[model samples]
Target: MSMAPAVDAGLALLILGLGLWIIAARSNFAAVVGFMTYGLMLALVWVRLTAVDVAMTEAALGAGLTGVLLLGAAARLPAEAPGGGPGAGLRVLVAVLCVGVAAALAGVVLSLPEPAPSLAPLVAENLPPTGVKNPVTGVLLAHRAIDTLLETVVLIPALIGVWALAADRAWGARPGALTPRPSSSSLTLLAQVLPPFGILVGVHLVWAGADEPGGKFQGAAVLAAMWVLVVMAGLADLPKVTNRLMRYTLVLGPLVFVAIGLAGIWTAGAFLALPAGYAKPLIVLIEVVLTLSVALMLGLLLAGPPKERA
Candidate 1:
């Protein structure tokens, strides 16, 4: 076997081992670290498979952002108490069962057929008409546009579920009691610098997305990060649930997308079909609105509740 395959195999094994270690280990902190390592290693595996887009996503969303979220969650959790109840025999049996299942899965994956002729050619042929260079994006926005629209709809309900779970808590609760007050000197500096830089990057990502790997989702995430930073730093307060503007912004993306999709059906006999000669501009408009909606949703998720203005 070539060295490349050998390296890939090593990395895959390392990721699996770390995942198993995380499951078997008693320490929550150690488990979180292991999960982070698994995410990074998984990104490497994606790179090895020549999926740069997936690799970037795994690196950003899985490793970097998820690790930060997990660490923050870990910090809020209570320390492990003495005297856990799982006996040795139970642990052993569970481990054995898990190993058996994993082995079965690996065998199944190994037995899968190799790639045959794919739909890439068909997609590539249609790319020019769609005005998207990337087949993945074209498939997402054009061929499977309904799926994309529905997924955005699902996001709102998911956010609602999270909000319902935390409804009783203060909307502006800091992570812990030791959460530093927002007016601290260093925090003020962060507040001032981070939001603009984040917005700049977010806009760039959205624009570059036309020809690059970035898109509405990634750009929205960056914009959301900026909103989160500002909210956490006390530079901007969360709006009340009754706030009309906040509610509108939160629902704007899906509403706009749906309206446009219906309009497409009227104009072109197909849902989400951009009018002839205006496809690129329409797609960009839809994406911009989607980015704004995603940013608002993310900001609301982080902010929890409306804070009372002092």
Candidate 2:
């Protein structure tokens, strides 16, 4: 008998177990660990569903970056205070609400049409004008360019929100360091050894995105993770909030995208519509700059608001 079903069943069980463990875990750190593992398993599930792009994104942002963020938060929080706990009634109510939400979601999913709605055929028919082989890329960059642009632009405000957490007096200062203690020799060594390879992989993901199951976001997440690793190991320090170059880097992606879109109105009669024969180059340029901006934004957000005077 084929073992694929057995393997899939095992994966499903493992994911469900992890979810329960995360909810039941007493320590914040333990819960964060379980959440990370759960994210990884979900990534695997995406892979099994043949959604490689989503799988990469899940592994990169959902598992890797989010896990770090939660870990940092857990580290910063104080230990549980004696006699300061949620009441059993509150817990029971929360559990009921969660179950209701889950059941509703399951019902909606199960009620989806037998064939399901899809724009894939339309995307394939229209993709050639966008000059990209990957249908997902064509859909994101060409067919839905405005949405992608808005998504990138939204990160600026999100980063600003993170910065708003700081005291006014700390406005221009550096963010809090990622870790409190001195780095161990092993961590330092891994920091040195891993970033080079990680960077290459990140770049490859962006470069290959035009025709493959990769994209700027996945690349940016990997790049951000490497930078975080370096900072966590004491090999690098977070930049000052008021650094001119850093500010420029943060805005570069969105600025370029908007500029390209404006030029398109004159050339193609529509904003964000790439002119014929130049689509691929313009798309590649946007991807590269967006990767840089996103990587920096994610890293800075994880670094938290400015905590020390410059």
Candidate 2 per-residue C-alpha lDDT over 85-168 given as tens digits, one digit per residue, 9 for 90 to 100: 788999899999999999999998999998988888888888898887878788889889999999989989988998999998
Which residue pairs show backbone clashes in model 2?
A: none
Off by over 4 Å in 1: 1-7, 72-77, 80-105, 166-184, 305-310
Candidate 1 residue lDDT tens string, 1-310: 5798789778978987998798877767788888888888998898888776677667766776567667767766776644666789998998899889989998988877787446888888887876877666677777788988887788789677655554344454422212326477787788788888889988987777766777777777788777666666767655666567877888999999898899998887888887776777777787889889987776565544333333
Compared with the true structure, the alpha-carbon lDDT of candidate 2 equals 0.90
TM-score of each: 0.81, 0.92
Shift in Å, residue 308, candidate 2: 1.8
Model 2: worst 10 consecutive residues (lDDT sum): 174-183
